[model samples]
Target: MNIAKPNSYRSGPDDRGHFGIFGGRFVAETLMPLILDLEKAYTEAKADPAFQAEMNGYLKNYVGRPSPLYFAERLTEHLGGARIYLKREELNHTGSHKVNNVLGQIMLARRMGKKRIIAETGAGQHGVATATLCARFGLECIVYMGAVDVERQQPNVIRMEMLGATVMPVQSGTRTLKDAMNEALRDWVTNVHNTFYCIGTVAGPHPYPTLVRDFQSIIGNETKAQMQEIEGRLPDSLVACIGGGSNAMGLFHPFLDDPSVEIFGVEAAGHGLTQLHAASIAGGRPGVLHGNRTYLLMDADGQIQDAHSISAGLDYPGIGPEHSWLHEVGRVNYLSATDDEALAAFQLLSKLEGIIPALEPAHAIAKVLELAPKRPRDHLMVVNLSGRGDKDVPQVGDILRGKSK
Candidate 1:
């Protein structure tokens, strides 16, 4: 297999962590010191070869690395246009790509001499992943989740509990991911001495969006090598669902400079592009939220609007700052898939390819199905199957059963 030389995509988020005015330290004065400390620690750790080797060892033995690039022959034939490949991140130990970031963050936490870890989750995958690593590392873990998410994603909530993490349900705001994030930040501020805020996505303030993206970029780095081994060239296009945009950023970052490679980031269009969807880029305007200035779902009065989605993971009002910047520069295509469309793609993949995808990635699959038929048969397309659907089975079953009735 041949490897491509490093490209210009690495020079982003300049000295102040601003990705062309989209990202910065938009946090309280109390949190500023902690963020700066984390930035310094991460910068030092990143340059150490020992840190890289240790992270690699854990990724290999603990979290699993190089998730398969599967050629979906049946799906390809079913679509009858582009060749389809699934980057099977769902096969990871904790059942999602969320583990990839958590593993790295936990290691960083340890390096910083932090004895406790706190995080926020929407669908619960990140919470579960964080709890899993905390258990492995023998650290105290506290996860804040929205009350509505706690009720909807019970299976994952159970998994986090079973792994011995404290799960706090936040009932504030719209009772979803955004509220959970606010609660977690409050926790971080109160316990900054012994705590490390293990943010789950490529969002948050400075260094975090950049830090999480670097750790998760392992997805794209592996895909680059694996694709060259099998296809002998780069894929024509790549697709992944975006909430806070970790997995999508992981896959798209490596190919950003490759003008020949088209990238698509799918957001949830719950019912429509009206007030009831989580398509931040599609239906919202720019605003400051979660310590970053990104496109957000807000009302005319500038109050954050409630975002709805069948998929809890993609039900966010804002996206990662880098994704917001990318969308503005037109480097990547931003699209949306409705809940109904995601459900159809979820079922289609399960029946046709024996792959039950998480509803998050199902949105990308929905978009892929629409785009594939328009491209040539020889065109190669890769989609990041970010997580397994086991956590979503109960919810999906209820929906399907209702529809059947």
Candidate 2:
């Protein structure tokens, strides 16, 4: 099937793997053929309304699309910068933005006649979302997560289990997201004929980065419409926390062509940017993970390093290629927020804005604190409240209180 080439702004280089120097399909030989197959299918599917309609139905009925784009008046006033609003993705069904992309993949799995779903998670939100979609569609689901993440994010682990997923704890490698992803890829290669790999971010092989973006783009679509209705103009800036960068991409993709809209991605700087316990933006060097070549916190020897953050979801060694692309193109600014700052924002939003954001989104909030005061008080800024904070309370409380009593 032949479709129009990716418009100039979207495709990577011919020889260079890039989403403008951010995306390239770098993979092991074993997965290359399947990755190419997925690329063809996604190219065709993206241009087909039948495929779009089916996924759109799931977004509306299964994942609850059109999540409210809320104007956080008090939050804006408190920031003392341009007026700020929150795309309340935390209100989306399944409590975060994961369901949107998962719904699309689960549907594609059914289309491919796949009977099982396999996925990886850090905080397990993506795992839970995938499991929920499988349960809705009557497919078997399995989730692989690092043993460390399973222990740190106990609540999400329980949530995934309750949703009928078998949570497989990976014990090898640093026992975190990257390791968990490695385990999931092994499962996918082993079960390639009848299993679907539901990636959590706008990453992985060709089809994955494109497919996930198309699904989650509803976030930005709604934000644009809502902003126009209320403000009679576009937002001046956009911000989201980056784990593997799905949420950030979803919120940023629609505005990519709108150069006037400033964008920022806040990475988790666990302690401080210069400290050992951090996953700051600059901490990672450009490298390949899974199927895509992107920025990763890897050593000169090219071994992936263990990433650290109070937010397990943000504790990955790399980010999505699209995000890497955006940063390199100068369309998106990458920043960092320390653990203390994120924790403070988590509580601050709860107390001041009555919106308790997940640790990941709270990192974006921390950046907002830095950015708001620097912009005009009336400038319009939008932050993606990616998920709810209930899952983070126990761990955050322990950190605040200094060890268990």
Candidate 3:
């Protein structure tokens, strides 16, 4: 697919796309037509007044938008650096920020008269969220999951099934998140006409990055007001994990041009940045695949690399185009934390704050502890609590036992 297109649905994506030479539509031929169609539909839907009103209503009443921007008093005292605050997306229904995007996609599906809603997930939070929205809307739903993730994150797999959505276990390419994405693309190809592919994150074709960001931007919008109420000014920093970049984009987009608020995107480094298992952005070269032009882990011939992370949600080679752009332009700093570090932070937050965060957010926790101690104690730091840990307890247990520390 060509990089230059005329759709404006994706916010801040450049005419040449590369937030600073980092983003553009990159995908297979069969899927291009559908991706473009989605772009048009999304552009129109976003512009329509009635559609906007309906989406707003669902966000407010159904998915419970405007989640609190809470002060972490105890966590702050422990870190003794930045005055810590958390945008508690973990409190959202279905236990993550995934519901926000699902609601928007389902509404678009309804408007399009689509008969079925299909989605791809990693940690299964997005799968469960999609299934829940499908159930609420009375639409048929199917979720494609990697066999590895399905087995490791069983609670979420079962939750999807119980929500009346069929769960298809994908078995290919390490049986992880990337494999699941390949399967999802195939499914979209086979049933493009009647089915709507509700990609769980911001990493997909053109409109998806734009669509998911707008829906999830409720995070920043709510935080803006919440911060004003307490701290009386914008935060000094905002941090979130960058799996396909949805939660990060949601929380970071509004603050992009603010100039004062520093933004950090923590990627899963797996074993470590130099290790073979790492998925660090700094270790990767810029390339395009899976629908958009962005930084992907590709070898000599541009074949995408397989990714590994203790957090299934963070196991992917490429990030959303917008993130790639932001990284290049210095609007955002994309950093990495090894799995061991993230796991350590996971245990720390659960034990210290009584909040067991999703593994993806644990990356942020690790970074917060790493950076917070260096900053002034009064500097405001807003960490996007992307999801809860109910789905991760089992995996966390296994990883902790396997460490043999």
Candidate 4:
């Protein structure tokens, strides 16, 4: 069911960076000035035509803009219902949607005269993008990754190193994405002068959530034009997987006010929502973590709970504040898929469509297996194939071969 359209769902995070009560600057006193400075610089750069032109040049020649919105004919026929189109973000340079935001941030960092770039990553896609951009811009780059992730996503760690980035593995907490972010934040606070924290997702404090979403919105923006060209009408549905929810937000924001479009944000259910899983909105309550107050997985004493997902990128304990706002208002339907289901979809897409999707978007594809078949044949559905599965091949191979669980 569609929620009645508001005056405009696009207007959000009022002057103080709040989306209702969900998003705000919940940072340490020491970082406030830096955050404010970033906001100011981003505002000035946004208004400057030269900044946009420079970023556009790099996006086209470097990261590759307007990645194809191809019809997944084989997969759609296999499902036998809604017409499915895959937004091929996986074809982007560095092999994910992360580069779209990094290019913008790195340019902004240069404008602000910041010489160092630091970031945190779980799946390594974002870290790779940041390192690539820093290397291109001749800036010092450091990436914090969980010790567990550094072990599992070894290929990405190597990629970052080759790009001249120093990768620090955080061993605290669950030794995963959340812990890596914790270390990155501490580094930002201590070295707040020359260091620029290039957040990978849309879950950070204030301007970060806004900044990342704006950069990534190109996905939805391009999809709109491409869909019109292909079908002569707006799409009926949009789907993407959510960890910290940047990719989903990227695809959903541009269409939020379109009541005709039904949006779904799929979260990874590692085992099951009732078991050890990463479906935060499904299994958890509202709380604060990593500078923003949003939905998080926590315990009786309000301590954070560990999250599990087959996809390293979707294994975070919380979601973006804008997602929380959308969830509360019933603007987007949030669904989830188990690891087993995602694995099945992963294999199905590879064989049927010859496209290897990253495990994160596999969660969305798993749901589409059910959702598409039920819709009419004329129903147009677009799914963001957010990244390619090359990085996941090793882990998936081990699981499928019964060498590891």
Candidate 5:
């Protein structure tokens, strides 16, 4: 497992955070100062070895760094083609990879002297993670979630509340992740003085897309080292689901330079691409939203369209700006999985590998199922199991029962 690092894919998003014309600061004039201040603080924090040591200590002692890269022997035998490995992010505290970014952001918030923390969540994983850290640090936490998500992901919502975080449900628009983000932005603009907006994904303004990616890059970094130790080389390919694309980016960023490692990003196709779905790159065009220019679901009149997906986590109308740029540059292959396909993969992994994946990562597993069988048995593939299915069991059960009828 010799590490093959490519230098071609390392550089990105110049000083202005433009990932080749995709990402930039497209925020309100009033927010510019705050964004700049955050960027400067983060730049300094990144340069300080003490900051890195502190974050590393927390990651190891609290959020559980270096999540296992376990080979799914049963699933590999079942597929009988490519060898499959699961990057067990679900094994982390809070049951997801979302904690990786939240912990880093919250640490930065504390360092910035901000007393209040505000965040937006789609499936409640990010909300729960944010709440958990705020409770740990005794910082005020407010999480904004869509009304629909609040109902569908009640367990996580309850967890946030129990952790002493206020959950505000936004009923506007499609009553989903996009609307929740809008409301969260409003809160940030109104309370900029004391509030530090901790974006859940790598899709916010300039510094945010860069900042979140750097924090979450730990996933890719760990995977590289673990795979090298196990197999004596890097994986042949990597796969992960994308909504705002943080987890996928985290796993993909470090491997970007590895030309031999094929990267695949799976987007949620709710029903089908022609109908309701959250396959942003497949069905979207370049547009500006949530402070960055990226591929977005928009109508002919340039109005944002409603996105739908069975997985609450991947039900967004747009993706991370870096993904948008990567798509244009032909750096990574973008694929999609329907709700039915993801559901089937979810059950298959639970039965074969004893791993019940969250619906979000199920999309990636679905893609692996399709590609693994076509490749040679010696081909190595890794899928980022971004979260556990504990929070999705009830929703999946209801859907399964409905299908039985």
Candidate 6:
């Protein structure tokens, strides 16, 4: 089962849309025609400079491109190790890296003449981004969110409603992200003729993982130029939190071929990897779910297992197929952080740097706390601060007050 390695790490998902043995057009026969049509449209759009110009315009003025890469001086001093820089994606218009991808997809949907946009969300950042774009473009938007997430991410749910997007609460399965995606897919199939499904992450089938990564890759592209400007060289290491792995892939893909640069993707470990958790590559096996083959949590019987994490965004049973491929190819290191560790990291960043990071990136910061100190002071490390902590305030407050675990 040894897959030949690519000469350049960025070359991926051959014409059939696969990265090694992972990723493909795994879907219902009825959806194949639509998928093919979407792929063709994207291919054409990609080749059109005008299309890119329009997307770039929206990115700069609408979604706020070139998010700051700030030196986390206080945190670096507190840790006493590598000089750490935070890729501040939290400053984006929608308050997370999700907008970077949603903007591109929404533009494509419009180009294809789709009038309705449907999406699934876990922590609600994607939902907020989609709703914001739909509102700006005067298109109809519908978001499906797990009932549990609807309750936990109430602020974002409210924001979606404010933007005139209808939010549907999915109650099936674990009533979490996986279920929300299941419901979104069902709706997409039912309305495939007139609706466009705006996937929030680099998962799903075929072109989605590719297109989303390309859109989100802005993070890494900017980091590269910014680092060169500030440090006159590439950073020694890159770290980001992973759920469906869009943000991590966005930042890491640009550096995959840089032999001197190391990369790390941190998965939420919930209580621990030995207990209920969402560290797919660390604790799961190969399986197909949500239209792609990737590392998924399952029982001996092969039934998908529910994933748990204090942060709603990281509570998915599987990582993106690209992440699975990278893990197998040894191109990137995958690690995990427990709920308590992420919480402590969240509070520490707020206290030390005055930066309130979302729970997702806090998982990366938890690992950074240990890794940074072990590296030499001259070592350069960049961590993606993927979102703001405003949405997590209520939930974190409850947990800190012993109201919830």
TM-score, every prediction: 0.97, 0.94, 0.94, 0.98, 0.97, 0.99
| Candidates' C-alpha lDDT | 0.93, 0.83, 0.84, 0.94, 0.94, 0.96
**lDDT (Cα, tens digit) per residue for candidate 4, span 1-405:** 244545778999898988877889999999999999999999999999999999899989998888999999999999999999999999999999999999999999999999999999999999999999999989999999999999988899999999999999999999999999999999999999899999999989999999999999999999999999999999999999999999999999999999999999999989998899999899988898888889999999999999999999999999999999899888999999999999999999999999999999999999999999999999999999999999999999999999997
lDDT of 6: 0.96
Pairs of colliding residues, candidate 1: none
Q: What does candidate 5's lDDT look like per residue over 185-254, in tens digits?
A: 9999999899999999999898999989999999999999998899999899999999999999999999
Residue pair clashes in candidate 2: 18-23, 19-23, 22-325, 81-377, 82-379
Name the regions of candidate 2 deviating beyond 4 angstroms: 1-8, 11-17, 277-280
Per-residue lDDT, model 1, residue 146, is 95
Off by over 4 Å in 5: 1-7, 403-405
Q: Please, what are the lDDT tens digits per residue for candidate 3 over residues 113-209?
A: 8979898899999999999999998999989899988988999999999999999999988788878888888988888889899998887767777
Best by lDDT: 6
Local distance difference test, candidate 5: 0.94
**Residue-wise lDDT of candidate 2 within 1-405, one digit each (tens)?**
132334444444344345755566766777777677666666677787999888877777767778888878888888787788999999878899998888878877777778989999988889989989888888999999999999888999998888889999999999998899999999988877778889998878676887788788889999999999999999999999998889988888888878689989998888776774445357876787788878888778998777888889898878888777666656679998888899889988999888889999999999999999899977999999999988888888887788841
Over 4 Å off, model 6: 1-4
Residue 387 local lDDT, model 2: 95
The TM-score of predicted model 6 comes to: 0.99
User: Distance (Å) between predicted and true CA of 146, model 4?
Assistant: 0.4
Best by TM-score: 6
Q: Write out the backbone clash pairs for model 6.
A: 13-18
